[model samples]
Target: MAALQTRALSKSYGSRLAVDRLDLEVERAELFGFLGPNGAGKTTTIRMALGLIAPTNGSVEILGLDVRRHRSEVLPRVGALVESPALYGYLSGRDNLRVIGSQLGRVSEKRIDEVLEIVGLKGRDRDRVRTYSMGMKQRLGLGIALLNNPELLILDEPANGLDPAGIVEMRDLLRNLAAEGKTVFISSHVLSEVQQICTRVAIINHGRLVRLAPVAELLQDGGEFEVKVDQPDELVAALKRQQWGGEARSEDGLVITAAPDGRGRSLIKFLVDNGFTPDAVSARHRDLEEIFLTLTEDPVK
Candidate 1:
């Protein structure tokens, strides 16, 4: 069964449509990424999925339970950290978890210790939240979410304010969670982080889904081999004659729709066999930032 599913989910405020017939299916133990520009209704969709707000025309199902109808049953199995996490500065990290845990049910100290250790707060868990960094606070919030041993976790920009090292840690943490059979859904503007962490991604533009695919497949299609030559037009014509193995087009060089592997060597040999001697050749896989810009700029295909 899918860990989460949304069927023609939609929301509208007055005359403005926030989410337009969004449909998605996320499987169990998958690290799913949700991406979009600001005002693309990512938050609105999340809120509706969490049953914080009612959808105007559709439904959300988590763990095979309809969110609207099984609020009491569904919520306990799901954990979420939306926007910035809320923490009490006056209280210690341990106290914060205790307070949140107290509301849920009777939580043992061993469980508290385990959560604190899992989120990397064991050493400083007794410290006041005000003294903790943004990364620490985020982890603390995550610890609270894990208190119930949730099966599904929904995070909005979980790595928003972390440093490079913190980002890496968060990535590893998500991967470990998924390995442990926990489903993780993250929505973030940090394309690189999403690229590294998520197995599959869904991009929404103008409150509608524009693209959805595996991270590897999308990167493979987006990357190109830069074929530099002394004569651009002539070399391009020659490549056309050679029947380039992959889709080839001429711009700054031959933007072949393939990563430069052994094919790069073949391309160089092909160029050398022809009249043109290359100036420089380089291989570059289109990173998430470029792919994201291209997708967001152009109309959804």
Candidate 2:
């Protein structure tokens, strides 16, 4: 069974629809990414999935159990950190974990040690949370989420406030979790990190899913090629004259234009045939950030 699935899930406030009829399925042990612009209802959808709010329509299931109908059975198997994590400033990190662990039933000290080590807080686990940096606090929040050893983890901007080193660590940690047969669903604005970590991504816009595909598929070539020619302006002007290269433009001395039939060889043949001898030519792969902006710029019809 899928670790997480939604069928026509939707929500609204008065007459304003926050989430449209959305359908999604995240396989077990998959590292899935959820992306959207501000006010796109990402958080609202998450809240409904976690049973924190009632959906205006449809249903959400966690591990084959309806979240709203089986809250007691489903919540224990899931861990989540949405937006800012609430923490006690006066308490040490270890004590905070201990307190939450107690509520989850009998949790051992060895398990606490493991959680501390996993979050890179072994030595500093006893430090007061108030004295920790923003990154440290974020790590502590993650540690708390892992205390129960959940089968599914849903994190919202988990890398918030992390430094470069911390970001790398978070990436590795999440990958390891998925390797260990845990389903990880993440929602964040960090497109680069999402591109690196998630195998598949679903992008929502105007409370509707606009795109869903593998990360590699989404980052594939969009028929654009970069040509490092001597006279970039002249080359750009010439390329624009062609019906196939009207979108051509010069950036950083490189003439970028669409290739006929979306092939690099076709572009090279055209350039050579037109006497615009190219110094270098290569296909340009669109990144997740660029694709994201293009998808979210307008509402889906």
Candidate 3:
């Protein structure tokens, strides 16, 4: 079953449309990345899915429950940390978790400790949040969200304030959560991070759905093979003679889409027979950044 789905969902404010006829589905236990640029309606779509805001049209479903009709029933099983971390500065990390846990009924102190540890804050649980670093505060916010042991976790830019080490830790924590059967839906403008962490991705541009697919498949479509040869002109000529169409340019190398049926080896052999030795032959997959820039370069009407 899909953990979350949006069916032709749209949101508008007066004359401005934020999200437009968006359709997406995230499989159970999958880490689905939602990627878009600023003003691409990523946050608006997230708010609609969480029932934090009403959609102007269409519907959102969480675990088969309609977000609009069953928000109370659906929300409790989901945890979310959107945009920035909101925490009480005066409260210690442990106290913050305790406060959130209290609202979810009587949660034990042990459970709080477990969540703190999961976020790599076990040793700093007693420290006041004001003394915590930005990354630490972010982790604490995540801990608060996890207090109820939610089945679905939605995080928007979870790595925003994290350092390199902290980002790695956050990635591991997310992976572990998914391993434990939790569905993770994350929104990030950091395409490289999303490419590294998410198994599947849904891209949005100009408030409309662009594509949704496995990360590998998405990369495959944009995959290009770079071939550098000593005789660039001759290589281009030979390739054109054989009707092997590709974009050949001077300066660096020739970039061509990978053969559909894995005939790259044959192409290399053809190059060798034509007296051109390729200096480097490498397969390049488009990262999230490349895909985002390409897709969002022009506004959708």
Clashes of 1: 0
Regions more than 4 Å wrong, model 2: 298-301
For candidate 1, write residues 1-301 as lDDT tens digits. 8999999999999999999999999999999999999999999999999999999999999999999999889998998998888998999999998998897788888999999988889999999999998889998888888888899999998987778887888899899999999999999999988999999999987789988889887886644567666667765555665544345667654544342354667666766777668777776567777777777875645
Alpha-carbon lDDT, every model: 0.85, 0.92, 0.85
Model 2 weakest 10-residue run by lDDT: 292-301
Candidate 1: C-alpha lDDT: 0.85
Give the RMSD in angstroms, all C-alphas superposed, for model 3.
2.3
What digit string (tens of lDDT, one per residue) describes model 3 on residues 1-301?
A: 6899999999999989999999999999999999988899999999898898999999999999998999889988999998889998999999988888777788899899889888999998899999999999999888887888999999999998889998999999899999999999999978888999899999898799988889988886744566787777776666655544454445455635343344668657766777878887767666767777887787454
Which candidate would rank higher by TM-score, 1 or 2? 2
lDDT of 3: 0.85
Which scores better on lDDT, 1 or 2?
2
RMSD, one per candidate, in order: 3.9, 2.3, 2.3
TM-score of 3: 0.91
Total clashing residue pairs per candidate?
Answer: 0, 0, 0
Query: Which candidate's lDDT is highest?
Result: 2
